[model samples]
Target: MGEALRTIAFKVKTASCGGTQCVNSFGDEQLAVDMLANNLLFEALKHSHFCKYACSEEIPELQDMGGP
Candidate 1:
């Protein structure tokens, strides 16, 4: 999580976190950085082989990660 956040911070400093991508489930504007962070964390959890499910403000649906 820390590493992922660090990556986001770097992106922010680099101006790589672009403008809004879309509106989230809460009707809030979702920025590119938000998507990036969400994807980063999701990928990390997916590769861990222990996270069975996940949900977030960006993707409110419960996702099956194929973990055991």
Candidate 2:
């Protein structure tokens, strides 16, 4: 989990993707960092197999991490 988080953080800092032109759930301009962080975290959690469910402020509901 730490490695995954670190990887995503690094990507967010270096990647050129993402923008504020798009809107988020709150109707606010979506920041690149926010989008990158959410996507990276979701992917990490989905594949980690360390938890049955994962939740985040960015997501609207819990994510079920199926069996490995």
Q: Quick one: best TM-score, which candidate?
A: 1
Model 2 lDDT tens row, 2-58: 876898778777876555747756677766777678877777777777767766656
Candidate 2: regions farther than 4 A off: 15-18
The per-prediction tally of clashing pairs is 0, 0
| lDDT score for residue 5 of model 1 | 72
Once fitted onto the true fold, the runs of candidate 1 whose alpha carbons sit more than 4 angstroms away are 1-3, 16-18
Report lDDT (Cα) of residue 52, candidate 2.
78
Name the 10 consecutive residues with the lowest summed lDDT in model 1. Answer: 11-20
Displacement of the residue 31 alpha carbon in candidate 2, Å: 1.3
TM-score of each: 0.80, 0.61
Residue-level lDDT of model 1, residues 1-68, one tens digit each, is 66877887787677654578999989999888888888988987887889899999999999987788
